[model samples]
Target: MKTSTELALSLNPAKPRCTQPRRWLAAIAVLSVSWPVLVWADCVDTRKATAAEVEFHGRAMAALVAALPPVPVGGKLQNKDSVTTLGQQCRGVTGDFNLEATRFYELNFRKAIVSVAINVRQLRTDAAGLSESYGVASPNRSAALRVNNVVWTVSGSDSPLRQALVDAMDRTRLQGWVDKPLPSVAESEALASQAVPAAVAVPATGAPASNASTVQTAPQPAVAPEPLREAVDAVNKLRGLFGR
Candidate 1:
């Protein structure tokens, strides 16, 4: 006698039912299609500041330094030697400078938030006196004058330092620091320029119920054609029909 399994297989020779594999494959295909859209939706565009922005910040810093009390003499003033001393003084003032810079950066570049720290140690005064006999005394004292490396930390989805620099340039009517010339308009006019446009909304496929507006309006009922008959015939027909 044949075994029970052999007898059963012989009775029903059709292919085995295996829906699990097909269901998994379909699920994977759907996931593959959807994953990219989700990733795209989450994507953000981040950009470094242009050279113009950097120059604008430098100019603004220079202006700030100019507005403050003049550097004192002897201690370190009015010569190449003064830059080191100036940096020392600037280091003292970095806390206040950073705060102001932070505020300025925010007001200008809303999308590109940034935190800035003025590194005064890197700045050096003019090196004009290097050739003179007195210049040989100390190698450390002769360097270029600067506010030092302005550590611009760009945070958020955008670069605020770049924005701040752009705004400051516009507001101050600065021009030609970068390769591009400033706009012909005044600072006020430049500020009145429009901001970046907002993104448009998109509908999802097979979402629980679409908004009613998407559905087309129902067409109005068509008017029936009048019966084809002369006026007298129509009247007679009506009279006959109504027995009047």
Candidate 2:
């Protein structure tokens, strides 16, 4: 007699390949969908994330900012729409600023700059020679530099969050991120390291004073006496007579 298992197999109709792939393949496809894709652990609630979470987000934002196109010389807003769009896209991307933060940042995230920070950020440029002086058909200057308005906003404000934002700007050279092409971290660090000193104060009474003590007057060349002048003229007259 045929084994009970063999008899059962023979009685059961085989499943068609067209209807389904091998069991392993079907299992894999099912598993792939069920498995959660890897993402930032704190992407859901950054405020609760530790310092590591903040750093992760900062880096993500930096990379996002770096990938942006560079600002042309003299500064222009070429990607105003792109920025708004990117803002929209970033809401879905983890580690970057939340685009949704726009709605909630001012509402609940003021203690930190998560939402309003990048939202308030806008590309700014101070283009020179744009007037009639530049001529009727001049090409856009290549010297355009794009800077983050957020930096200036924080700079002027007394917000406790200013330093944190400033630190991000320095590390990422984010001030130029959107308008300028990406630069190496080393390049940015070097630029930030060479900080410009504060301007010297001008006198309240008037214009600033020059460092006169450092100035040096050129020495005057030796001059012949008045008698020497007359003597030279007389010599010239004597030479004329000799020629005669």
Candidate 3:
């Protein structure tokens, strides 16, 4: 027979077996809480790395511009055709000047084969009655840079949309914009415009026949023949003498 205490201890259910399932459940709960933090941390790290990359690229682009010869005011370094394309894109863009600027920069600069290409992805405009009512200055801009595909940008300036561009090149440095091969449309038009028509000759009408020996030429009627008139008179006199 057991003492009351021993009986109480025995009756107390054997410590519920801590099975693998319970351990797994605890692990899952811990992971569920920690996973978000880990994910957030990873996201932060990625953003920081991207920010650094952009800053480096921005600096490089700035340096390239600084090295270039000065471009005369009103004279663009990029080609006129490229500028035309940029203008077209700008005209089509609605409301966001920064977006237009970014697109223009990307088209004119980033993809260009010059010494440097700066892509300004987003920018902030301080104008009333714009889409966003809360018009606080924000660093909501992004850019992709390529000096042969090595990227760069302004730090703390990353936006999924709307940005401005700052180019560091001069007209001479940007001359590559013109150096790019002319588009086929312009070339073909130029060729077509320059082409000349083949020459052809036509014969004149009522001119003297080339073979003159085939027909007697008529005498021009400008003057009567005096010798023929005298001969006719002499013949009339000879006829009168023969009659006598």
The number of the candidate with the highest TM-score is 1
TM-score of 1: 0.24
Comparing 2 and 3 on lDDT, the stronger one: 2
For candidate 3, what is the TM-score?
A: 0.18
- From the highest lDDT down, the ranking of the candidates is 2, 1, 3
Off by over 4 Å in 1: 1-58, 62-100, 104-113, 118-143, 154-213, 222-236, 240-244
Instruction: Residues 152-220, candidate 3: write the lDDT tens digits.
Output: 222112221112222332334333322232223344344335433222122356767577557778797
In model 3, pairs of residues that clash are 54-153, 57-152, 58-153, 65-168, 122-162, 122-163, 123-162, 123-163
Candidates 1 and 3 compared: the better one by TM-score is: 1
lDDT of each: 0.35, 0.36, 0.34
* TM-score on alpha carbons, each prediction: 0.24, 0.23, 0.18
lDDT per residue (tens digit) for residues 124-181 in model 1 = 3432211101111222221222232322333333333333333332212222212233
Query: What CA RMSD would candidate 1 show?
Result: 28.9
Poorest 10 consecutive residues by lDDT, candidate 2: 129-138
Measured with C-alpha atoms, the lDDT of residue 40 in candidate 2 is 40
The residue-by-residue lDDT of candidate 2 on 63-126, one tens digit each, is 4343332321222331232222222112223323331111101111222222212322233233
- Give the worst 10-residue stretch by lDDT in candidate 1: 129-138
